[model samples]
Target: MFFNRQEIKFMFDENKRLNSKVKEFAKKNFHPKNFLFFSDSGSGKTTIAEKLAEELAKRREICYKSNDSKFIDYTNQEVLVKQELIHNTWLLKELLNLCEKDICPMNCKGKTKIDVMTKYNIITAQDPFDDIFNFKKRIFDENPAYSKDKRIGLHRRFSKSKDYTHGYMFKVTNRYQSGKVDFQITCLKESDDSAGDINDFVNGRFDIKFAEETTLEEAKKRVYDDDFENLYKHKGDVFLKREVDMDHVLGGVICDVDTENHTFSVYNKYFDSEIPSTMIPPKDLNRLNERLRNKIINQFGPDHEITGTNKRT
Candidate 1:
């Protein structure tokens, strides 16, 4: 026997009630030791969490004295991973330097783009694609200004003060199981604003930053290299004037800028690698700035608009 529309609506409302009841039960009875919440969207999971917190407060004297709530909405987990990688960048920088040497072992008479070097098949002894993606290429990109001696200044690029704050605001866990300090570490960046209790690099208090919240499905999805290529391909018209779009784009674009070298590495989100680095050529710097100014004007239009142009001439 099929139910009428009235009955169906009743069932839907009743189902919601039952869901809330179940959620309440799960929240109160279950102890969160090493737990993870996995559920579909709009399933009252988050609502249940709020309700549970209310219930817990009602049951006991709840304290909210701590001022450590900060939120950073990572565009995706890859960006979070990039932040973690930056935290342990000393180790990565060393490995990447060796890879750079392998790519350009000796002084060349002329400049060599990384892509060109790849085509020549001379930089194939070791592939660091998996280790740090295209970090080596970005760090060692051929630029006439920097490559005059066939050597790039790692000091300029790897300046810790310039790259990161001395505050050590980020944290990663390193576990030792076999009597050896584990070099391979699992990184977790908290999206919650709860990690702001510590001091940041410049003797200032650390504040949490958020990008946007990711759904359970998105959090669980596997990120890949092709995804990044697709993102770049569809980067769309850059209207830097729009704060919302800038935030969205910045979430996806993770780069380590070497202002001295005029080069920066864009992290490959999908492949867990680095893309070949790029630079604004010194010669074209002025032209690039002019073009960007024109593009912004074209996109945003003139600041002043005629207010009283309704009268017909």
Candidate 2:
């Protein structure tokens, strides 16, 4: 909700564009591919990427059951849905299952568990880069029980499969709330053999870059200004003047307007507390009550009681 409708739409479209590029590569190469997205903290990259993942999973007939934390592949009834309690373990099991048969995992009977991992998979590995190396070793080199021919078959199936889709989310800049690890290092290493930088997919590198950063305070101010403008158009200057004067007298910021209580709450930064409407001047308080009463009358055909205003309506 921090972004407006148009902003949200653009974010979704941009991610879809990136996904399309991955799909195009998969189609042409007949191999699985992944993507990496980098942006500053609080840029909503995770939100947008997760949404695209969910959408793609649904298209692939894969859905996640939150109660059991398992991704169910509705298309493949034979494969059991595994609970994703451990990332590395879950990934290992899925890949091992794919290797159970010699056929390409992409053209197998049903969608793979990797298809339903909307949150984070190998593509978004936040752990150390060694984890990836360990995974490769486990799959192809570490296991001694399997014959050399079996290991080679597994590697061929995995490398040739065109069904895998993954995305990596990385923050270009760190903030107070962001993690300290540099994910770009992992992303670059992962993409070294897969798809190149995102800019390679889209023409004009500027199109792939994120917009200018907007701070939380600046976003809130934009919402406040839009609300104030709309309210002024409806209620005129008298109501607006009283609201401003009340803010000045209370020496606090108007945090919220509680229409149901017929009061506007103010937050005093000095004391870190909210000032009650009782602290407002009697004249301004009366004007606010009158405004609410008029609003109720005009909305409810002038038959509603003065104290019977419903905020929901």
Candidate 3:
């Protein structure tokens, strides 16, 4: 029999309660662990993630960004989407502080760039800066200024110390993981500020980490193994271990997607043999392990049972 008015109201209320419960469960318990969304370039992963993030944000869960280095100093304030989003900056305000002294061209004129070159121990400058700065050299090839000791007595000084310039300080990071990522985040470092070191990145201190477009083996070696785990134990960084027991089944974006053609591969880690070898996941995710799945088919016919995302339906 059909329900009456009161029963219908009660049913509606119960349905609402169940829907709310499902949302809560998904928000709390549902984690996409080593899960890959097989989609094309315009398949709308970010669009879906955006809607999901907005819902999660309203729940007040701690979802900060891990990409920006500029926000490290201002960690206390701001409801940051990405914590390190702005931390690795060479703050222009620092130059304002430097300008409190006498007129300095490097600080007063244009954009000042700084870098920590691993090959070069000493930091150099484009515009001549500092108080004790002097003309180093301006030796011409044909008409060489060999006797170039003007102050000492023989020749004139070639370059003058630039004393009136301005600049806005800025800091940068390694290339981002993807075009869709909004988080400009980075992590805390134990060493001095160094720009764009792969070691610094793989160390994984920042909120958002990026796996650059590189070799599959290289990505696997950096994210997995003893050294990475050590950083986990010491730095308290997030560790999402991807355990696999398959060959050529590395986990990442299923590169070169032609789903209609039924060909794809992940760039994470896979096995060459029985051992965990470094390689991409098999191009054909549809390929069934006849030996392994045979147990199921023995009980029931091959076409009767349903398989999960682990293998193709």
Candidate 4:
């Protein structure tokens, strides 16, 4: 428990070095809004995540506060560590809590708050892909009306546009379960036309210009020929059409930490790619992972497999 001056200095230098490495890693990977940290149950993923979050808070001049597994709040930004899968309902609750506190300075209102409110968030999980997929499913399931609408359905399935800055028009066709087929056009961005279309759709009126049902051939022609000019004839300026996946909507960076190997890697699900791993000092890894294991066993019980195979005797 007692360390000489030299030993104390060595510890300080090592801690500083590790902090620098973590900051650099974050700068390179934390662009997306949603990020994940995955590894073995006792890999110290949460510990590293907390450190990263703290460093970010310091850099962003935000308050760093955490309440166990609930969330590591960093004012506008946060690291979500709730010991459960990330789903729409849970996420909405957490976001509302964050918003209610009015911690962030941004004055977001209405649907935009639900869609693109947060500046950044980190979600800790064991399986990143499964969590991401489940989150998207929850979104669709909870909003059945939106899911059934041809425009929303097609936008959810085929829209790959990542340009969040501009508006968009999606034209597609599908057969309903009632044995009725129709081509539908819808606008995704916030605009007068899109707003009117949404109001009409909600009021049981499909007479809006944007919700017009046309032939499949015509829809294909507009989509394939990049026919924004004709489509937006009276609407507004032309907007680009692209796929907008869930990853884009829930943007963030993901980091996968490997405690056994004393390294951590970053991943951006939107790009579907993995960044290389950065080596952690073995001493730091051993100390953090041991602390994490003990904490997990204490919280979840010794029988929890995360405590590792060698059970306490």
Candidate 5:
């Protein structure tokens, strides 16, 4: 194998146990709620979540929320709700809980008049990095041209002898007599304060900050080697039969509704392809309304495909 067999085996075994626990939790007769399963990169969190989504689908209409449309391509068992849906669902849950206690002003009973322009501060924990990484991953995976541009840019920026550039430390990992393109890695966050952005965010304010480092070679392999099949080994094949143009739907841009034509237009910077109103699928028209809602920075899933097209992460 060209990879670490031992690490892969460990991940597979741990994911099996994690999937069982997730399935059990999903099977319980609990309130309709949102569950977030998170882990470090290449740790099989998505692998386990995909399996759990299948097991949960047996009970209720499970929705797989992510920015990555590829996940939707691999599974028809769950509804694909983008990041907006996930946030709306979470907010709805909070409002419902407050309503049950008769403390919310926006309760269905309408005991009091709800006022607009109220500057209410809603503070929620946000995972901004994961979303960003995933969105970049999707683009790097799907658009070879964009990926090549990035790779070339990095090489140019770090052309000096073995050293660190910005936060990344580039080093030649192996050399061969055949004069093959020498394999190298760009490692980052070597120490607790290596990442200045992260350091600035949590420095002085927080005493503890956790970090993990992975080689560029391993990261790139994980991206290219990842397949939807490993996630659904026992579930069989899944085909997307919907007429929805996912490329437009999940391509990351908010659509503009043309009321006169009764259609929507989506733009893709990657292709410079603007989906004309006529090409828009009726099922995707709903996303036009979603754009009206205030955009939240800290959405549920790590910024997936949706963030790739959105105005901002």
Candidate 6:
């Protein structure tokens, strides 16, 4: 099936709305308690972080670094905080240990932070690309709900004879198509240098991250996606959702909140598919997906539908 513009536009619009809500929160809790980069489904938290950094750019600059810094110790990257963190210094050095400058083709290989940022135009003060591709599989599988934009998808990089993006390369893995949409789903690892760099600079920085055709989940991850889902009350609505019918089961949803204008939204699948019923203690999604488990029946099993229905993966 071709890409649906309405879904993409709708998601983008939700991003704008979510951005406003985040700004409000920033205004309320603008202090340096800590830099919070989070979101549920359509609440572009990372997008906001990049934008905030971009706005901060008016005053300062931004840097991006590979997430490996979190795992590795003794990272050469300046943003690599010396204090004990998620990843140790040895791990950091071990990771970049061999990154050995992109120039040394003989020793160095794979995409660099600069490589990915340049492609995406994210001028963070630190580099965060090297490890981005590392967790591609998990990022694509669990986080972000995406809808490919065909027009832009048709738009190709200057080098490619035909567009060479889609899930295969970026790891978005659109189950709908044999080849997935690259820009459709993105990776959002919380322990990223991008945000850390912003925190490093108390002054902050201005940054614009156009995660075009990607979902907030893929762009950010469970850490922020979880925050985004619960960040709805302030939006002046009750139920807010972003409907995407690209990959995995159904689309995404932003449920439970009596906000103002825009409240709730669900994936095209929920809209397209008829609601299924559940008896007593129904099945969890894990069991349902297991074809062997005749014990599990419908897709919206008890766990996924009633309890675990906040968002779709």
For candidate 6, give the lDDT.
0.26
Best by TM-score: 2
Position 107, candidate 3: lDDT: 24
Location of the lowest summed lDDT over 10 successive residues in candidate 3: 115-124
| Model 6 lDDT tens row, 187-295 | 2332111112211122122121222243444434312234366322222322112221111121222223122221222222213343322211221333222331232
**Which model, 3 or 6, shows the larger lDDT?**
6
Q: How would the candidate models be sorted by TM-score, starting from the highest? A: 2, 4, 6, 5, 3, 1
Off by over 4 Å in 3: 1-193, 207-313
lDDT of 5 by residue, 1-313 (tens): 4549899899899999888786421111111112222223332223333433333232334433333321221122222222222222333333223212212233222234321111011111122222322224344533312233333332222122122112211121112111111111222222222221211111111111011233333223222133222221112322111122232222323244333322222233332223332222222333332331112112212232242222221
Candidate 2, 166-250: lDDT as tens digits: 2222333333132111223122322222222322111101111111243334323322244343222121111111112322222
Q: How many backbone clashes does candidate 1 have?
A: 19
Quote the lDDT for 164 in model 2: 28
Instruction: Give each model's clash number.
Output: 19, 0, 43, 16, 6, 62
- Cα-based TM-score, every candidate: 0.14, 0.27, 0.16, 0.26, 0.17, 0.17
Instruction: State, as a TM-score between 0 and 1, how close model 3 is to the true structure.
Output: 0.16
- Poorest 10 consecutive residues of model 4 by lDDT? 199-208
lDDT of 1 by residue, 1-313 (tens): 9999999999999999988876421111100100011222322223323332233222322221111112212121111111112112323233223222212122212433221010000011011222323333344323112222212222221112322211121111122111111011111122211211111211112111111243323322222333322221112211101011111111122123332332222111222232222211121112222443343234334331212321111
The reply for model 4, stretches above 4 Å from the true place, is: 1-32, 59-84, 92-117, 129-313
- What C-alpha RMSD separates each model from the true structure? 27.6, 23.6, 28.4, 28.0, 25.1, 24.6
Q: Candidate 3, residues 187-229: lDDT per residue as tens digits?
A: 1122222222221111211221112233334333433244243
Clashing pairs in model 5, backbone N/Cα/C closer than 3 A: 67-305, 68-305, 131-302, 131-303, 252-309, 252-310
lDDT by candidate, in order shown? 0.22, 0.30, 0.25, 0.30, 0.26, 0.26
